[model samples]
Target: MDTKLLQEIEKGTKSALIKKNIINYYIQSGSSTITELSKVLDLSIPTVTKLIAEMCDDGYIEDKGKLETSGGRHPSLYGLNPESGFFIGVDIKHFRVHIGIMNFKGDLIDEDLIPYSIENSPESLDHLCKIILSFIHKQNIKQDKILNININISGRVNPESGYSYSIFYFEERPLSEIISSKIGYRVTIDNDTRSMTYGEYLAGCVNNEKNIIFVNVSWGLAIGIIIDGKIYSGKSGFSGEFGHIQAFDNEILCHCGKKGCLETEASGAAIYRHLKQAIKDGASSILSKKILEGKHITLQDIIEATNKEDILCIELVERTGLELGKHIAGLINIFNPEMVIIGGTVSLTADYIMQPIKTAIRKYSLNLVNKDSKIVLSNLRDRGGMIGACLLARTRLFEI
Candidate 1:
């Protein structure tokens, strides 16, 4: 082919891909009219109408009745064929792995949870792979119909290269590539905090917010930054290590080999450690019974104790909340985000945790910045990372 002709063909192919992506976006966002899609996709109404008509004829989309309008005629709404394809999202945490399966229309089909410590076993990856395979088999979905697998892990991840800095013992090969080869599927990987941030952007508390911060305060603390309506994975995809920021001069060592890091003071692990130490020091509390009974007191136990207004649990949570809030206040001053969402299992405590955080924000952050930023609890909670993994797969599969 002539060079000019080849260039023309490439351009046409790119345009078609973009149009198809628009269709996928509409599908994921639920039913919408051509006018709405055109506006969202930045395409002309005539072009959107033509593409929608083609998709309808191809059985990829169908008229889903009409949407009520203010004054004009009801607009015809189009939605995707639910049976078109499937997606899987896997969230690999320190102590558990969560899997979620969804269809083309973004409806969650099924989910599974497997509890296993990644740090304790060398064969954790093999076990995880087996569980994933078993879960897929249980879904009764064909392998070919599954578009992609998205995995979110806690660490610095290069989404494009599929390598994680803090996982799989930093092995020679990229984790995503290895998993894809084993599972016989295309795979994408990302940092768990970033994934949860994107999840909130798509379907949680930070929806439609251009500038936002999502803080995950589980076993550890991490923050996800969103700038200009997109996840801001800084150079080397390691931007959101908020937990490692220096908070105190105490000799307490952090897991990252640092002393007095924010995570050492404010994370769920930190809270558990402090509570255990206090119990060892003969401090009286509800959790002391568990410790005396030779049972390890978990973060959940502390949260439940706080619910019952136990003095020790209440005080410890408040202290951790204050520490976390101080760090978040610093983030607010530096990033000037429109919103900050506190997520993870700890956030379930509601006012007990949030009250102290709010107070600390007021005391530490600049009045102008703190007053404008809305700090709220995440609606997605622990599921944000898994949902985000599915969204990541959908975005890549449809090029949306």
Candidate 2:
């Protein structure tokens, strides 16, 4: 190897070692006092103190406050500084953008929403950029202080470059660069479902659990696989594209230009669409009048209908649940994850959804895996996307 290459390699090794110790200290104690970190990292007090002082000077950590002392004086507590830097997480949905901010410890500081239609044209990108800039300005956070930005989009994101083959009609641009240019931060973009899984592992459902799967069942179905507390984006970062999985022999067209996809029959958007058609076909539902009034139908509507014992609505939700359950069963057989965290708008009706999913897993998945695996709704619910984006911002970049 070249002499310069050798020197650069050595520098890289030292940088990793330093970052590793800092990350280890943060992970072990959640937040660490400088003295505690120095001792834990096994360096001499003075040397450790110097390193910490440098870190503080670099805005990686800060002196939070003093701990109360019984005698003499109080000891200052040093921790990963919340204000030293910020991260932005944006979940780009079919209808809305859910954005949130997080500090180093993955604590959500604030969130906002912006709605837009999925026309997928040049105008849509302009609209998205405007919404993001407006949100950043409204928060009053310094753009320079923003270290990382994570964006989740609804289509396949080329993991190597952050380019997307989109369903919506927008100018094709690398999402990471687009956001980075506007926000002046290092931006990471991934598939929405993968981000949800990453979020569950970092803050919500699978925080302590090592093996978990986050299933996103909204306008489309997607899976986020966490194996041993890490998001498992297999070859091409498209490993968990669950929506296109064949679920029926029926001739229903799917968004992916396929037929009989699980998403066509079971996703929240499907439920809303199915209910509208059912009512038009003289199906009896209390929601019928609401639909006639031009009220927007959501997953909540079907759930509420089930609560009121509306036969058609109940059947609709139950059937969707049954299809979802079968798909989950296939996941259980393949991944054998310890927990299956169901997320998305549809998961608000977890009680009704879980029944059929559980039944299907018991019927189709291998007994060995299904016996210990659990299927539950995400604790974060609506917050998974944003929280996941926050965690995604925190993730160390993988080098090939």
Best by TM-score: 1
Task: Give the C-alpha miss distance for residue 147 in model 1, angstroms.
Answer: 1.3
Q: Candidate 1 lDDT (Cα, whole model)?
A: 0.81
Against the reference, the lDDT scores of all candidates come to 0.81, 0.74
- lDDT for model 2 comes to 0.74
TM-score of 2: 0.85
Give the per-residue lDDT digits (tens) of candidate 1, residues 1-400: 1123123334667555755676557744778888888888888998889877766665557789989879879889888866667889999765678899988778789998888667624377778888788888888876667878998888678887788877665468888888888878778888888888888888787656799999998888899998998778887788799889888888988888889898888988888888888988999898898886779656777888889998998898899899889889899999998999998768878888899999999999999888889999988987988998887777665552
The 10 consecutive residues of candidate 1 with the worst lDDT sum are 1-10
Please list the residue runs of candidate 1 whose C-alpha ends up more than 4 Å from where it truly belongs after superposition: 1-12, 27-29, 39-46, 53-60, 67-75, 120-122
lDDT by residue for model 2 (95-142), tens: 778998887666788898777665667667667778777777877766
Q: Cα lDDT for residue 380, model 2?
A: 83
Best by lDDT: 1
